[model samples]
Target: MVATVVQMTESKTQIQHTHRVFENQKKAFRNNPMPSSSERKENLKRLKRALLANQDRLLEAIDRDFSCRSKDESLIAEVMPSIQGINYTLKNLDSWMKPSKRHVSVLFQPASNKVHYQPKGVVGVIVPWNYPLYLAVGPLVASLAAGNRTMVKMSEFTPHTSSLFKEIIEGMFPEDLVSVITGEADVAADFSRRPFDHLLFTGSTSVGKLVMRAAAENLTPVTLELGGKSPAVVSPDVPLSDAAQRIAFGKAINAGQTCVAPDYVLCPEDRVQAFVDEFRAQASTMYPSLRDNDDYTAIINERQYDRLQSYLEDARAKGAEVIEINPANENMKDGTRKIPLTLVLNATEDMKVMQDEIFGPILPIVTYTDLDDAIHYINERPRPLALYFFGYDRAQQEHIIDQTHSGGMCINDALMHVAQDDLPFGGVGDSGMGHYHGKEGFMTFSHQRAIFSKQKFNSGKFVYAPHGTAAHKMIYKLFIR
Candidate 1:
């Protein structure tokens, strides 16, 4: 009872703080609605500097949150990308801010048309627990580059990291320019409901629906970076070792707690065993041992750990072959929340692992008789955020590219597509919607206001009124024809 009362009070306080910070940012944005390109670049540079200065602190906090998060993984996945994304934005902000010239029709001669990229007043970024630093910093970089004040909602599950992030950000940026909100689910829900010029959410698709629905109350635009069953297809002719090595790396990174991680593999029926063998060899080589491996990352929490364990049980009960690649074969029930890289063979649609996004080290191997069958299998399901195809055959590659639909693709690799600064990352259909990264990200947070101006001329007046004048007739004949 006392604990409940205290929890309620804390929730109330967090909500109040979130609301106050939001209003302050709105007011600050009103005062300087469009920051110059140099100002935006400076903001980005400050963010990068802060991240670098506190790199060790941020990494330690993330490690504490996950209980056993790998520092090397944190540096590679979180810190490096966050800094690189900021640098990318800095390099391109000037060009991205420039107004785009558009063609003016003859009917409106002596008039100029262009689109001014105006900053949206404020942006709301909801970060997920996995890859907290990168997810939060990626969108924040884009929002700042677009000249918008931002308020970020960090995942409650990552308390140590979230609190540290809030401290670091608040120490450098004023609350009116940048703020971080942290709390449990209720606070996240409240954060989603707040009115903002734009909101970007990164998490599960199920939760994305709730966020989108909340944003709709204010008709707030959103860029959702949700996850789905992203698959990697191994071509019949491609070397199984090469494909398996890349797929293993992608799945092994962050222990497969990545949105774009290869959730499953589509291989030819004849090569299923070979692919599995190669994957096991590669994954085992990377970690060598799971129990005390500093390189291996544990699942984020107990709840997530239990959820992944249940997936293995469900798959086993459904007759899927559960292969645990425990190189050292040590017991993992030591409260570390680490699960060995397990492969589920002959996964069925009825199983939970096949139905939902497997955001862990469990990779399901679904074999197909032919390439057409593989393409058909993918097309039959909801479009994935990313699809990876392995093979150098130009014709086969083009065929897959032409046949299927996904938010993004890696022809001979996996997860590397997102690291490229110039490419726009997003999803379609159930995977997600809207893009952010590169120019698309800047545009996503900016209002492309179309402008048409004319000086000392009124070409449009010819078609204004009075039963269509001769000028209007001539214009219609010229344009309508």
Candidate 2:
């Protein structure tokens, strides 16, 4: 019995080792300081090579974790984006690394001003389960490019992929440069509480708050990629088939687990039925059945599946017409707990589906009388992470862009806004706090230190010593005026 007890305790101890791993990484970063530009570029190159070499393994791991994540989807969404991000960083790293010169006023003519980009020591990246590899490596690539050491805490939901990634990292890089931590939420909480120089969290809003509060204890700066009820506005001018096909594809990808997925659709009252019909036809062609369709992905786990079910039930209870385009039995033996590509008509603002970020395959269609009404509806809510507008009318597109505030916007497309490395990705207000990806990611991880150099000749000494003199008064008046 004592031996069994000892074994159990040891197992628990091993399970809680993520914190220790983080501490070790922190110490390593402190010892080495910031890496040079060459080092940063080399590390990124190694990462790219590793990813290219083990592409098949990485896809398999993600598929295993997500149950039915397609190879094409994983490659397109995760691998390609990561590679593109790396290439973008590599091309601009030299310019990004250079010190930026600042203009000096005549009053301080003797001083030269500039800003230096410095690494913020070690950065902690807390990744979410969906798109685990992309989230983990994407931030890691940016942190490395910014000359900062990184400590990554992979989501426990993707254990197999996380473990494989950890193994890959151990083989390629030194632990002092990059370390991987994996465990349950307790370990994640503990990891978040650590005193890292910077922390970037990609997860839900509730969890983002916890991470923020924890980082506050250390006064650590954070970048939060949280979720919100991102909307897709279909103007009367765009073709119904095009709008429907784009929205349906975006909502169905990864079973709508994407943070930037179109949560709801806002269409003109007269075109609601036409939009619904087109959406149904497109969804049917894309996914014939929720159960055995290889293109469709299952919910991450049973809890999320049930949460989606609850939303559907709530909408139905409130007299909303719920339409399932490709309905399948919830109980199936093939490990596909597929929720239908559903549309809820007559969904009111007070309904549960509209109240929060619907992070599943359900799309709520709300009808609006005019463009102003649609804009008003979006503006009333907390700004979303992404706002998608489908229309060929340039004036209407610009109107939506000008009236609302979202982290990003895409015209005539859904979720494709995030595909551009040139654009910054994040949220505003309740959605999230900071932006990352491409150049923004580098800036997030770096500290732009304002530096000023004074020349030998004391040009501004007159203003420094005598405050009440007439000459000082004249100088001050001239400068101030």
Candidate 3:
């Protein structure tokens, strides 16, 4: 009973702290509501420079958290995309901020309409454990591009990298302008409950519900980037080797812990064995020795590792074929948390691996009779964050594009569309909702307020509240029709 009271008191105190931070940012935004474009650009420049200056330390911190995260992977997935996103935002902020002119109806002469993009004050970003830096920086770039103050809540699972991020944020900007908050689950809860102008969360679907429920209290607008079982469909015409190699690359990176990684593969019945062989060859060539290879990354923690193990065990018990791809036949009983590519053949709808997002180095291949069968298979499940199709047939591709539903898609390749700065990235249905990248991102954190103005005109007087008049009748007949 005593401990419960103390815990309540501490939570209340932390809530107060979060509220204070929001108030400070609110006061600062009111002081400078419309900052010049140059100021926003300067903010981006500082963030990019700081990132480049401290790239090595940040990478090391993330590696420590993941036990054996590849430095090259960090440079490619997290650092490069973040820097590129900043540059893209800097290049396009001018055009994005310009007021868009709209045509006025003939009924109202000497009137003009326009839309102005204004900042939404404070934005709260909740970062997940995977790709911590990129997820945080992506939203931060958008929020700052829209000229809003921001407060970020880094994941507790990644303490080292989160602490490093907090240090960088503190050193680069004023606390009122941009602040980083880091703690356990309770701190995250408090952070979400605060009434920010807008909120963006990138994580699993279960946690996303809690975040959204908390935001409902304050009516805070949200942009959720949740994950689901994204599927990859291989056309019959495409060579088995070609499709397998591309899917292998997407599933191998970050040990297949990526949010947009190819969750499963749909191959023709005759080609499943060939696809398996090609995938094994490709993955083996990429990771020669799983136990000692620096190129391959490990699971983030013991809980995740055990979770993947249980998934494999559950599939095996259900009579699904399990093939482990260890080129060097390395033993995993040691302290190394690394896992080889495990393919589950003959996967069925009832298997646990088929139901959940296996965010690990596990790939399941299911056989389909025709293209329509593959499309139906994808449609039966919840929409995913990403979908990949390997085929060059233009008509078939168009049919797939027109029929399938996913947040984002890539054809003839995998996981490359998210890197394109010109495209907006997001999800639909259970996967997620809303988009944020490039101009779409700028618009996400901004409010496009519609303005209507008239210049020394009395046209509106013709339709005034005075009823049963000739002018009102003529105006109604002319305009209402």
Candidate 4:
């Protein structure tokens, strides 16, 4: 049909335009391969100011996109962290930019070595829908701090947020410096295929594979912040009530739609009942009534709501006990897409809820016999983005820390390590790879090129290509060891 052909042509035109913008950014980067420290700082400060000024609009836009996103959650999770990351980047720019000096070996006497951090020209960032603002802004902070021009692709799931984000980005920066592109899956595909020095994507694991595959064609480096079944372990020694309360808080925020939110809780077999009871009580205290409560965020949309509902149904049909904790017992049918904090107890590996990442208000509590049993269970599965352990025993904490593999861990806490500005945040193995945040973020977007210099007092060439001599043998003997 003519319509189909027209649509294809439009898509092709958009892809060509994306390439033009990329070339412009690359040209800009070439003009100034290394931006001065003050220039980078000014850009960061301007970004901080833009975020602060548009805080209310951004929150409102996100709220519209999610239908019932909590304003407090937006402030705490999205806006606040982004500003904090910018501030952290600003605070350490000078120290990070200074070239690191390295010692030279005796054979290379009169020569010195140093490592200079330079921008990777243009970086491509693919942002996800959940925490749309933070996901985009976080990588932008890192990319800018490393003095790189960035092109960002926003998710199509959040139209309002995406448009507003594009507006805000354009207001603060020029197209060639920092640009935002709005598009569907095809656009994202085309954007990924375009060559970039480095690309960072934050989303599901399946989609991450496709993005990486596309990037591979261009040999583009990538840093994927993909999600997984990030687990929260309640140690046997820890009181059920305490662990439940902490896990409830982490899961309740953003309605458990967070990548690092405690996906499932590993409770002792005997303490499962107590954990469920405490979680309900704590969730009730946090969200007195889900229907009319602004503090409790609703599921992002009807599709996600239906997906979670199917998960609950599938688990219940498979003989798992479903405990729906509705504090007010309000009729959820009254045009609200809110699902109470439901606990799927006795969940087995066979169920879909256990197999997939539950990015909703559904929490599956898997009972474990003991500490080693819990560790083995986690080890058998693909690695998670985060691991949470609750207990006061220093020795047991050390044991878990030494035994397990995760992107990050927090002893006696859940979702707290991600807030630390000094720590590196990322995943391991199947969860994802590479690190960002703090100095690691700067390094991730930078090229740490080594520079070696020789002075006038350089030593004579001891090992020429001619024949082996006593001096060459002596030099080899002294250095090779």
Where does candidate 3 stray beyond 4 Å?
A: 1-16
Question: Model 2: number of clashes?
Answer: 0
Candidate 1 — which residues are off by over 4 angstroms? Answer: none
Provide backbone clash counts, one per model. 0, 0, 0, 0
Worst 10 residues of 1 by lDDT: 459-468
Q: For candidate 1, report its TM-score.
A: 0.98
In TM-score terms, candidate 4 sits at 0.97
C-alpha lDDT (0 to 100) for residue 156 of candidate 2: 86
- Per-residue lDDT tens digits for candidate 3, residues 70-117, read 999999999999999999999999999999999998888779999999
Which should have the higher TM-score, number 1 or number 2?
A: 1
Quality of model 4 by C-alpha lDDT: 0.90
Which portions of model 2 show Cα errors greater than 4 Å? Answer: 1-16, 327-335
- Give the number of the best model, judged by lDDT: 3
Q: In candidate 4, how many Å is residue 163 off?
A: 0.6
lDDT digits (tens) for residues 1-481 of candidate 4: 9987886787788678789999999999999999999999999999999999999999999999988999999999999889999998899989999999999887888888999999999999999998899989988998999999999999888989999989988999999999998877888999999899999999899999999999999999999888899889898888877888899999989999988999999888998888888888888888888888888888888898889999998999999999988878889866688888889988988898999999998999988898999999999899999999998898889999999999999887888888888899898877788889888999999999999998787476667767588988888889888
lDDT of 1 by residue, 102-200 (tens): 999777799999999999988999999999999999999989999999999999999999999999999889899999999889899999999999999
TM-score of 3: 0.97
